[model samples]
Target: MDPLTPMITTNPFDDDKLREECGIFGVSGADTASAIVALGLHALQHRGQEAAGITSWDGHDFHTHRAMGHVAGNFDRDEVIRGLPGGSACGHVRYSTTGETSLRNVQPLYAELNSGGFAVAHNGNISNAMKVRRELIRRGSIFQSTSDTEVIIHLVATSSYRTLLDKFIDALKQVEGAYSLIVMTPEGMIACRDPLGIRPLVMGKLGDTIMFASETVAFDVVGAEYIRSIDPGELVIVTNSGEIRSHRPFGEVHPRPCIFEHVYFSRPDSIVDGSSVYSVRKAIGAQLAIENPVEADYVIPVPDSGVPAAIGYAQESGIPFELGIIRSHYIGRTFIQPGDKVRHLGVKLKHNANRALIQGKKIVLIDDSIVRGTTSLKIVQMMREAGAAEVHMRIASPPTKHSCFYGVDTPERTKLLAHKLDVGGMQDFIHADSLSFISIDGLYKALGEAKRADGRPQYCDACFTGDYPTTLTDQDDVVVTNQLELLAERVA
Candidate 1:
């Protein structure tokens, strides 16, 4: 077989060119925002790990601590969080989407905008950033970072709105695609979600204090009471008086949260939109066993993401589960290291296959999704080298054939192997004996009981089906500039 023949490289979309979205957390009315944010970020750390940053405002000024590493590594000493004193603050754990994985891209981006100023933390991607950036450049907006979140900073600075809330609302109106944001001004803290609800944001209460995070699990870690999600198209303000105010920009935009969150992104202990992610993954695994049954000596998950599904598959297929791969918890930001040699070394440092469990065995390997196919190919080779007789691949979800416009960064269709090859072709490409993906219906069913009417229970499957709840328009992509000037003139 010609290696070049199997390589699907003619993608109109650039390969190895996608970016991962980040996670944001903020709290106000608390005695120690730094310590609270550190603990909250620990719970939401799965959302991002490249860098961690926190900004605490002490009435007069903002004190910050930021570094390029895990929360534990970055804030290793108690004095680190304790040093930043404030009643309210905002923090960010970043997975860079546009910028390089350097300390420069780390978040809790603080800027002295208006009278007092604004510090921001953001989750999700802005699809129109390039377009917006070009226009901002024309307006003489000096950008400090390659991060799209910086664009919002520039927009807020230029807005002629009355309050910081007005500027935030105005800035959001021009952006498109997914975003769940947390911003801190001298006066208060603000939390907002996109009109389409592409990402998840929730509100919680810690006595008189108000909290906001990308996941409810963060609130739970801090002993905060869950107080529902920040609704689609909503902007919430938490004042010093502990008052919460809500605003809706486009109330009619359909609520379409990212489906990948339940399938593979979120922790099993976390719940989104009142649905359990663990049960959803397990159900999908059970459904996959029924839809694509296979005879195997043992069921092995790809560790981490595939564990729950593999358990369900084993129970449904009556196959015994085995721990075939061991993952090293001490892996640093290995993905940030450039070069294939470095990346390969990082992989070896992170995961090792157990030869005793896989040797001379017919094994079923279950994973979440195969993106780019590089990692999947390497894993298959690793299994074969470990003496596996035959490796059957089972995917818990359907193929990620399209790039997500929302937070979950994915390459264009041209770069996706599933978009280019059929199941058989994928098997040959990955060097697997066979490969099967769970059907869409089976996936939906495995997600458990989704409320048919939103009152029952439901989920967002836009990644699999591309049935977007809201349409992206040219207006949504328009950059904030003379348009704002015209609006100001009209108001005058």
Candidate 2:
């Protein structure tokens, strides 16, 4: 059997891409904080679906509910919303990594610190969390959950600082990685982004209440007016009386927000980092067309994720855009119940080639990315089966050659098809007539930059460039441990 066969390379149910870290939302000074948080979390559900949580502080006590499931199933009921009562609240939607998807790791993780109660909703991964966790444990700190977010709570609990704000600042100074945090204390709500701002966090307003969310789309969902982003290294403290204070205690550094948000993580309507996500994607597609033009009868998107780029490609290339492929979003999760073989064959259950529109047409297929190359293989096969004369593939982003450590859950380096193969090899493996990816410079140009600065830039492109801004202490420690064990065996 050929190793590169479509059956071997594809999975009908698997997207083979990076999963978003988490989405965090908070509202301070709102009358119905928890209820408004539910609506906001529902809007940001696309960010995560594995688990959801919300915590509310009503002047005296903090109330919380954490569950493993979509926000729609777990947080939509009026009774559930009523259980969490307060004028200030925060919530989180998480996509836990495989083998770590337990309810105990759900966010809005709470603790009874010396300063009353403290709860935090986090939207990033701490690269040095495990290293800090080991040290904290050695110092006799009892752990509650396996999540990295728990580290912040323990850090706050043990801080020598007198005030809650000081303790939080102490914690932020010690750890490293991407984080956009919404922390709730008895007195007020605290929102802060990491020094480099590798994650997205925005501030909005609904009347007198202040809102903090991972994206601007949540503001639209909850009827909030977009304000501006919480600048990297900056902290904004919102008091119970609606008093807001801003501080830049982390000092100055090159703020590198995640570029992937504009490419795929954020909703099309979202305005992230002062630019429209849809507009960035369209520009990416246009750049791709200018960089890699091909003659075809029609241009077709892979659907949903690929639509914006495809539209830009079609317009820029002067090719007619048509519905060459149709997607069935309703076929989610249900495909897993039919067993592996059925699931693989049923990739068509979710996406099928539009035979009528595609027949005899030479088409250019546009997609946001190709993670493991599996979906591309299947989509190309489906196009051929639908009587398409030629299928030329164009990717909106550069090949994702490195796995992400800043909260995004991605396949290991060995499993990444792009990391394992060159461009020609990928084209052969995916069975496309021609394949091209937007150059890294092209990607930056689409984001309205002349080109990404090699040493300093506006956003994190670590997945493509492999030039990580922070020290991956946890990952490096694991590698060191493995090397030590190998040396010990050789000595024996």
Candidate 3:
């Protein structure tokens, strides 16, 4: 899981279908924690694309710098980071899930409370946010942002607990959903994982320095010794004295690591616990070759995220891998745009089929996952125009039939191609010669043996299996209201 090495063994064709949320990194050390975290966040910019933010804590006060762009673009020089002046810092790169893509939703959310402390930075979604907001309003709390994460600040501020940790625990108890939070405060830095382990949080150390991040990749960037995951429902508090206290409010709940993380979200070099995301993804492609083998002259990856799996598929299926599409490195992300025309144009401008390699060849196109059918359709059309004899599409993950409220931006079920059509039906819709999705069982096997601390084996397939770990109400207004009221009173 060394970040120095990438797992991809072949060239891949980058496409628009693979989308991911951003990454987070936090550090508590002797000096320039904000600058260190900025570097760490830069290493993790691949996890998110919309925005980047950093919050630092000097002994007397907290300073934050945030902007809407890549880390390198936003925080290019040391002076930008040095200006913050804090020994404890938390940084985030955000891909919006709630509201519009504006500075308003950019994370490392800061609130200066009556407690004379600054609370900043949180990750993941609150399914009960609408309910929580309602509750906060009933108690006279005003919200300045549309993000669900703001509820956490209000909750912590209003809690009756005497200590900050106790207040956080109480605030968390009232909300339900996926979250892996890193909070920077005057007292210290706190890291916590959700009860279901739906998102990842890991802790690492470099001598007296303590670091936390959404992925282990950050540890690699900061030269910190890799520590294991922060366990489902576990909380670790690092104080000014460097004493670390770990708490498990929800002990050993069956961990359901977000399957999508392994499939497409996390860095290929990051090892989640003992699991190698790269190896698991390759296994997924290999397993796809076994269960859903197709006849094609060559195998092609959808690029960037799709390469490793495509290599495994090619190796297992006895097909040679080739770069059938060349992705334009200069183009901005396909999903980021001011209008539908721009977004659509981005897809075509970003990828151009290699007519020399693709012409008159039976092509097996492998991709991570498909959300809306639009991107796939355009891609298929691209391959066809390039004179492909036949295009057989292979997906490395199970069909996504449900929306992800936990932060990955997926459309509603009806908009999902697999939700309405089976493999055969999807083939017709996308004009592919054939189509196959890796089985859920195959996805599990590819991820390698799953072993729970209690000796059970399981995973979260909520997007595909619809087995949500927590229940969020359908009454959106009521849910946000209740959560808001409860959080406001608890924090106030």
Q: lDDT of all the models against the reference?
A: 0.76, 0.88, 0.78
Say which prediction, candidate 1 or candidate 2, comes out ahead on lDDT.
2
Summarize candidate 2's per-residue lDDT along 1-492 as a digit string, tens digits: 000111111223756666686999999998889999999999999888778999999898999999987898798899998889989999999875545356778889999888889999989888888888889999999987887888889999899999888988999999989889999998799999999988999999989999999999899988899999999998999999999999999777788999999999999999998999999999999999999999999999988899999999988999998888899878654245666656566658778898998899899999888888878899999999999999999999999999888888677777788899999999999999999999999999999999999678768998988989899998888889999999999999
Error of 2 at 148 (Å): 0.4
- Considering TM-score, where higher is better, how would the candidates rank from best to worst? 2, 3, 1
Question: Per-residue lDDT for 1-492 in model 3, tens only?
Answer: 001111110111233243456588989975878877988897788777668998888888888888987888688786787778878889998764433456866878898876666555665667777778779979989987777788888998899999877888999999988788898777788898888888888888888899998888888887888888888899898998798998988755877778888988888899876688888888889999999998899999977778989989999999999999888777655334345445455556777899999999999999888776666887899999999999999999988887666656566567788789887888898899988898887887786654222223376677887777677653355558799999999999
Clashing pairs in 2: none
Winner on TM-score between 1 and 3 is: 3
Determine the C-alpha RMSD for candidate 2 after optimal superposition of all C-alphas.
Answer: 4.1
At residue 274, candidate 2 shows an lDDT of 93
Best by TM-score: 2
List all candidate RMSDs to the true structure.
Answer: 8.0, 4.1, 7.3
> Which lDDT value does model 3 have at 240?
80
Off by over 4 Å in 3: 1-18, 97-100, 334-345, 450-457, 474-492
Per-model TM against the reference: 0.85, 0.96, 0.89
